[model samples]
Target chain A: MYIESQHNDRVREWARLKTRRGRQKSGLFLVEGERLVTELLASHVHLEALLYNAALDEPPDAVWNHPKSVDRRFVLSPQAFALIADTETPQGLIAVAAIPKVDPHYPSRVLVLDAVQDPGNVGTLIRSAEAFGFDEIVFGTGTVDPYSPKVVRASMGGLFRVRVIAADPARYLAAWRRRHAQGTIVATAADAAERCDRAALGEQLALVIGNEARGVSDALRALADRTVAIPMAGKAESLNAAMAGTILLYEAYRQAANGAT
Target chain B: MYIESQHNDRVREWARLKTRRGRQKSGLFLVEGERLVTELLASHVHLEALLYNAALDEPPDAVWNHPKSVDRRFVLSPQAFALIADTETPQGLIAVAAIPKVDPHYPSRVLVLDAVQDPGNVGTLIRSAEAFGFDEIVFGTGTVDPYSPKVVRASMGGLFRVRVIAADPARYLAAWRRRHAQGTIVATAADAAERCDRAALGEQLALVIGNEARGVSDALRALADRTVAIPMAGKAESLNAAMAGTILLYEAYRQAANGAT
Candidate 1:
């Protein structure tokens, strides 16, 4: 279908997906840019709609060939595309994908986000978590919506691969402790005595990352089996929350893969 | 001094420092919020001017007590303070500080950025570099200006602490190689066979982090003595540039401080 009017009901509805409330209500979120849209087509997630700007010479083969995955395809005029697009310069492609089902069962490696507020941080963590073999992501209270466009873009398609669940980390981790008796629940803190390099991260691990300003929440911190801090040589007070999380996750992966070496 | 108007000459000059060209011409940059402003005052760098929002109840103790460090101090009306601030809600304080001198001598460890465009990425890398003991940062041609407000803010005062030098990495590393013949220069690449965990990172090292979309630049990659890739366990194509750099820096620090294992 060709969409010329920005005010069309579908265009307005798609634009609403930009907001958290809208996405929660619609169970859909926007994925912009050609790379992300292409990745979406490859993933198991269901695509509700696909859009390409009319100005493009032609939609890429992924958009044109993927008829089975996408419920609807759109060739939108620039104005119509702009209405539903998040970027200043839309990549001439966008996709509306249904929010994938949250996996209730935990994976061997889980990344628990306590209240990581920055979308970029949340996205980067997700990307790193996926790259480092972290299979499950649990979003705790006050955490930014991982489905937000900024996060979806920043995840670089990693969002689709990982299993994400929204839960209160303290309560969930408490229950998680019973299921896997040997699992290590680690919280990252700046002042923790145990260096991440020295911490013995077991195979089944849940790493809890916290807010940018605040370290891991007290309740979650207390619940963690151990706290690991990345040893720093400089006097700078701390590392960025996301960078800290990514480094910790990498450390965990390295330990598990090759005994920390 | 009291400044009530946004059009005040000094206020306009301070506002101009928000842009790269303005900062370059004046050799000054703005640091926002009470925390960052406090950090600037604590650092050895000279403060050009200090502005505080009159409505902040009282200026922070660091601001009030540092009369010797500040060349000029002004209490600006809320509206005037807003003009020179980058954040939507001005933090009630901002400082104009002379750009600290870039140290010419190479340090034990260095982080070379090659066209890393995102300000947040650059800033996070700087913060992580400081935390992980990378003492020198060389901003390659095409890289974002480290003095930009966004980079400084994202750095969380790491910018104030590190030695930043602007130069082409290819040229700089070539010179560095001659000076320290035993030092190793490593470039991060997704496809590189050497795992970062296993890579033999010597005490003196330079890690080149590239642009968001591209890995290390071809010129710098060729200059690097060896290439290290953070081994991945999952399907993620690659980690965010900043996350990747931070992890590598942490790994290098881990090796130097506590042998890789």
Candidate 2:
């Protein structure tokens, strides 16, 4: 059916999901662009509704069989698509999907973000973690909402792949360290115990990245096995949190790859 | 002098430097925030002018006596400061400075950015390169203006510390290979000959990073001594160019540090 009326209840409901509270209450979020929609269909995510420009042809046969997928797709005018898209240029496709349930207990290299408030930085870190073979990501207090549109876009579809769990950093670290006694907990700091190159990041490890303005909290710092810093030769005060975390994650990936072969 | 008149020629001239054409023609660019102004004062850059809110106390004696110092000073009202500042929260200082000359010689562990147009990514890559000990950064054709306000802010003053040069990758790489026979050119690609983990990046290396949409150009790809991919276990199709470049730069730093001690 054509979404002809601006006052339609369904349209208003979808628009409201732009807010955090609305998204949480409905267990639904919006995804835009053809690439993201294609990936979502390929993955385990359940689609509540699919909206697209009427000019485009029907979706391929492979995407039509999912039981929970929306069948009453709306044909949006170009102006309507533009209004709904977050970007300056709308890519002509958008969908409302059920938030995929993430397994909280997944065992692998995990990244713990502590109060990193910048949405772009958090999203880029998640993308980097996924690129470097990390299986899980956890967000501590004061961090930006990972499902926010800015973070979601910055992650480049990594949100769909990595298991993201939000909780308290200190409690999560203490519990995880106690359970996996042998696993290393390396946290990035400006003034640290050892440079990352010298620190022994083991096969089972958790990397803790901290806030943009402040480094890691004192309590979380104490919980870490060791604090690792990226060595600086030039006068740069420090690297961005996402860049620092990405470097460390890739280092772990390098070490593990070398050890395996 | 107090900048009371909005129509003042000097005020209008300083404002024009925010544009690429104005910056290029006048050979002057704007740096905002207290931290970056302090960095520029400490670096080799020559400041053309320093502007700040009239309410703040005079800068320290050391800031004025730097080898390459602030040539002119102006005091503006808080409203004017906000108008001139790139960020929402102005830190009460901005400076117009001359671009320092940097040698374009073959560098050890150089970063080659191929049309990575995001200003923040460009700045972040430059900052990471400095943190990881890459000596020089070269921007390929089609890249965004490095001196843009967003790039300058995101770099966190790394622009003052690092050696930045612009060139066409095809021409630069061809000449670089001939000039330095021992150096290795490593281009990052999604599907390539070797994973970045296994590549020997410690020696004199030029790491080529590509644009957001397209991977490295064919001309540049053909010039690479080896093409390397960051291994991905998750479903993400690619990594952000800055993140990928940062990981590779840090890997080189790790190897170089290991070899040094």
Candidate 3:
């Protein structure tokens, strides 16, 4: 069915998914553009609605072709789509996916976030973490809503693939420590921390990423088995949070993949 | 000199630094906020002017006290400062710095950008590249202006530290080949590329970073002595351009620093 009015219940609901609070209340989030919608179709994630701008001659065939998978398909008028669109140049399609319930599983290699407020950094980290074969991503207190559209978009469908667990950091990690007593819990700092090469990174590890402005919190740092630093050879103060996190993740991946002790 | 009018010629000139054309014509760009302005002051980059809101009774002494080193200081009225401020929360200070003249030198380790176009990514790569001790950053054809404010801001002042060279990709690499005949030329790709671990990286090398959407350009690819891929064990197809560039850069730095051939 086509949605022509911005005030229509479906359009309004989709618009609400754009926000963090609305995403929490509804337990849903919007995924836009052809690539993400296609990813949405392929993934087992529950979908509420598949939307397309009817102004186009036809929506991309990859999406329309998978009509059997979509729960509901809404063809929106240009005006209605415009009202719900996040970007200035909308790709003419979007999907509403149900947020998965939290599942705290044993993590083989974990990417732990502590108050990482920037949605873009969070998404980029997710994408990198996924590429590096990380199993679980735990969002500790002070982290942004991962379901926010910018994070979802930046994740490039990696969010669906990885198991994202949001929990109170100190408590969750404290319990995690009990479960995986042998696993190394790693955090990075600039001056005081040892170079990552010198750190004893094992096969089973958890990387604790911190806030953009501040490094890891003292509370979180106390929980870490070891703290390491990516050695800087140049004059810049430090790497960006995302870059530092990704590098550490890459280092962990490298050690695991190459059988480097 | 408290400039009170927004329409003042000096105010208009400062405003013009926000644009690419104005920056190019004037051979200058803006450094905003207290941190960045402080960074600008610390760097050897020549400063044309320092402006602060006269409403403060006086500018911060760090800038104001360095009167002999600074070419000019204009204490702007709050209205004039508002007109010149790029950010909503203005720090009430800005610095206009002279863009350095292009100097051609054979870099031991080079970062060559071939159309890698997000301003943030470009800036992040600069930060990482510098942190990893790449000798020079060459913005090949299609790369965003390194001096752009967003890039400068995202670079976290690494822009000031790195020797930035903008040149045509094909011509620059070709000429570079003649000068540094012994240096290894490297580029990265997802498919049909040697795994980075397997590749023989060297101390003197040129790492070619590519467009966000596309891999390295044909010209750059042709120039590369070898193309290596960061092996991915996870489901995500590839990493973002900055992440990819950074990982490769980290690998280069790793090989160089660790004395691992």
Index of the highest-lDDT prediction: 1
Of 2 and 3, the candidate ahead on lDDT is: 3
Residue B180: error of model 1 in Å?
3.3
Candidate 3, TM-score vs. the true structure?
0.90
**Any residue pairs clashing in model 2, and if so which?**
none
- Model 2 chain A: which ten-residue window has the lowest total lDDT? A59-68
B41: Cα error in model 3, Å: 0.8
**Candidate 2 deviant stretches above 4 angstroms:** A2-8, A52-69, A75-93, A170-181, B3-8, B52-71, B75-92, B105-107, B168-181
Write down the DockQ of candidate 1: 0.59
Pull out the clashing pairs in model 1.
Answer: none
User: What DockQ does every candidate get?
Assistant: 0.59, 0.50, 0.58
Ranked candidates, highest TM-score first: 3, 1, 2
Which prediction has the highest DockQ against the true structure? 1
Q: Which has the greatest TM-score? A: 3
Model 2 chain B worst lDDT run, 10 consecutive residues: B62-71
lDDT of 1 by residue, A41-104 (tens): 8888888988889988988885667875454888899999998899988889899999987656
lDDT of each: 0.86, 0.77, 0.83
